[model samples]
Target: MIERKITYQHSFIGQQFIAKLDFTSQYHSLYCARLKSLKYRCISADESGYFSLSEIMEVKVNQSCLIAGIIVCTYADRSSIVEKYISKIGILADRKQSTFYNRRKEEDFIYLEDESGRVRLDLKQYFDWENLITGLVVAVRGVMRENSVLEVIEIFYPSADPPRPLLRKGDEFICFISGIEIGNPSLDPILLNLLSNFLQGNLGNDSAEVAKNIVRFVILGNSLYKADKENSFEQKAYSDISADIVPSISKSLEFFDTFLAELAGILPVDLIPGEMDPSNSSMPQQPLNPYLFPLASRYSALRSFPNPYECKIDGIHILCTSGQNINAIMQFIDTQDPIKILELTMKWRHLAPNAPDALGCIPMQDDDPFIVEDLPNLYVVGGMPNYQKLVTEEGVHCITIPKFTSRQQVVLVNRFTMESETLSFVSVIQGMNNC
Candidate 1:
């Protein structure tokens, strides 16, 4: 095998999200930071200059003006921990709907708010209600009606940063594997072994050549799934329940560690925790404890990163998440297209805009880490239903990787060319059998 000649490096914003938690920080601070970060970009994107922006308080009634603020959605059924607690006090709390999207569309209200105040947005004509959601920072040009509602005429989103030119050209490849679900009893051992063998160059000659160029591998969340069914209604002693849970969790982690060690032995592997993973149930989930992977931890090629991770590989900035942010966004939007959802987040210039509202997020007082201060060259969201990829006009490679356990496939991207393709273990073996 020829020596792989390519430069690779990465730095993470993990520390920004890892600080000691102080419950005093209000969730509003996150919106404030988002507004401050992207407001100028929205203003600059409005090249027509049809209306100049003003503070919500400064807008004159019936006069055309632009205002930048965070979106807030109000509805009787919107997700709220306070309301949920209140509902739990009732007899039927558990029967409540898990999602607020089922509420009648007419009952929903939209508001644009800043430090001064919030105004209802009369967007019935200009925008699709399902496309907009709470917590997005945007600039809207419109006239403030006498009824204290803003009749919007135009909307402006933050401009995307241009992708930097590719620094080099080669066969350099990076593999993205998501939703491994290692501990699931339904997982196919055959497929698992095939994936390992293919990656380790133990397959055919062509497979060996391809695997040799793989510079790195990324495991994007759901590495471990709760395979055991919990009997929610069955009564048990607290100590007994804890005792049963510990063994199950330990067993799952053991399997994940072994699985990861195999891949890390072949190439550097970066692991991001997911919704099912045993990490904090909040946005910017911290990395899984290295101690959990005693075997894999011994390998220098193994790295555990937080959800919504960022780094630059070979000068191409990559922004990735374990699919929680995207999944959260799906609850509010009408479409299921992952690429379109990703594009919406790109336009808003914020990741997980619905954080702390529809989803759990640590209250960040200093800055909104979700804000995309700079657009990255590669944007990846893992654990989608299927693999999807699109290179935006701005040259951002937006990719959604499907769960490997289900698809029996993983996404392979040419680092230098920004070209992407899915490599399926099952199909390769079938092809080999046919030959």
Candidate 2:
């Protein structure tokens, strides 16, 4: 067997040290140099050019450790060492191999080398190795020790660059954070401003509504973007409209009430209650009961309910039914006005066979008949044999009412009845008339 002599030196936090030794030599010189730079007190070199920390200060046995150093030289099967150490610059490289073990041993440990020199790392730390390999630079801070082959006390990745002040853009970042990488920098400004404004509540007065509208816009925009990759005119238009409207809308409870009322008038009555105000002989004061209609004998009967579909009180016409076919109803109202009808029937087609006896026909006030001046001469007829045909009439439209198949219909109807009862209670409490 032949022996080789090696010499090495290292500096840490401004202090410098040196070491000289004889070992089996092969690649031991490079390994020794790295270990020396780590400031390990005692070192031993092996035939494979691997070096171990024979002793270290302030270190205990069986304790985990971290070691880091720059690669000096990585030779072929034979070992060699770099002669000089440059402070600011360090070389990066990696290598891997499998080792055979005797039957007595269950497995062989894998060895990993980095700027910190060599250490036998567990398989679980594979990702740490990968990060190092992918050019992710890290500074590790760990415990230091001697008396064992490993020199590091602990290890961690440190930020190499100086921290910069984040640019302001509303409440969001105008620039990506340190770890976050942006593929395209062009949208940074817009994203920043939008985020900042959102954070500052400057986007709109109705924060919740504005947020909902923004989310809706984003969803619709993304859908459109997917469907039309090249052009998003519809998406742009919707965003523009929402951005403009959301800022102007008041955030008061009254605004919400009014908004809900307006939406209810246009939507199905069953889906949203109190959308329409009951007819009044004269102009009523504030706090109107938007939902003021008698319950239909049967759910299906709602279809045959008269049109213009709305009745006027002191010239203000209000819709009476919350039938499912709101779009058709609205169209009918739009096309005709001063609608008149006689003998209208409200049907409940979805009534359960076992449902309680149907409520009989109910009377309507003189002002309760559906009549919309905005629409052409129109009439809504319920309980009339020609109601369906009237709905299909030229300039007049009809929507076929759907029947509930499951027992769910009964539950829903019962729920509505209960809700009406509750509303009556509320009205009584508020000293409002329940007509």
Candidate 3:
């Protein structure tokens, strides 16, 4: 059934399409998950890390004081702006230029940008510790030099006490599994059976209890593998289709529909689209066409959401995206470790800050919705090459939910404590054997 069609004539961020989303206002990211606005603050050293920086700017030129602001390079493109200044802290320029302005010689300058404007930074003494991650809001104590540079100073990161949510009397659980890859032969068969049994079929004892407590299951992305082995569109033209059977998305949907219908029969499921799915190629992908899932559609519990999904369940704030954000970040960052990058990115308050540079996201020219106004209780990235989870020192649970085709492990989070545990179906079966 076809309804009104909203057109996305342009790929830019500010483009307006009279669709389900509101482009005029503050847009949510990864597929917007609007929630109640909570109280948060950016602070300085003297005041509690809870006081706003705007309320506490006390430093003057030649006097030593602490100030807080977002870090930015003068140039728009971060790649061209070399960190050559890492070695030397040169004198500040008289007037800030949109392009590169030589302070001493070839020494690049870094600026602390805030509500007022930009102030050139001289970090020769603290260059080593300034392992400054772009987009992080931090406080620095230094002498504002006559030459316009903020001389070598001490850095301060704002801190906050983790918000504790009151849990219900009954223990609850939510499962997160990514890269479903339905109908793909590469998927582990044992994992499938274990899931079916523990989730919908008969699984006695502790397992059944776990299944019942699992209130919601989020399928991050890649529900269908577009191209799999045994399918050769190049070899099998119009005639060769008879001999060699090619993989079909329709067939994949058939498998997904059965799975969703079965799973939705027992519990609610949220499906997100990956690059391989028939959704928009850009970030903030729209929900999949419901028409494809005729069987699953029969159940009110089954629904499809956009990638980078966000929502709150029982007061727990959760945000997730199919691995695109992680992939883009790893390419720009020095390390391949996902946990390290995710931990740092959370502080920046934006999921993909380096987007439109190294990453391929729709450039939202007007306003960036990717900016995380409030931190989530749990953050998940699907389709990771491996499985990993870390309850960050800051108290946010960062998790990488892996693809089902490779690893059968799905993440299980305690609905009350927000604590996470990785569960591998094969291991569970083997453990059952021992019991």
Better of 1 and 3 by TM-score: 1
Each prediction's Cα lDDT score?
A: 0.79, 0.22, 0.61
Instruction: State model 1's lDDT.
Output: 0.79
lDDT of 1 by residue, 160-253 (tens): 6687887778887889989888767777766777887877888879888998898888888888765334322211222334455677678878
For all predicted structures, in order, the TM-scores are 0.90, 0.16, 0.66
- If ranked by TM-score, best first, what sequence of candidates would result? 1, 3, 2
RMSD of 1: 3.7
Ten residues in a row with the worst lDDT in model 2?
Answer: 215-224
Q: After superposing candidate 3, which stretches have Cα over 4 Å from the reference?
A: 1-124, 127-131, 136-152, 155-162, 166-169, 183-185, 203-206, 226-247, 427-435
Question: Model 2 segments beyond 4 Å from truth?
Answer: 1-111, 115-118, 121-151, 166-435
Compared with the true structure, what per-residue lDDT tens digits does model 3 show for residues 210-280? 67667777888887775544222111112223333334666777877887887877777788877666666
- Compute the lDDT for candidate 3: 0.61
Encode model 2's per-residue lDDT on 215-302: one tens digit a residue.
1000000000111221121112222333433332222223323322432222112221111211111111012223322232123211
Stronger candidate by lDDT (1 vs 3): 1
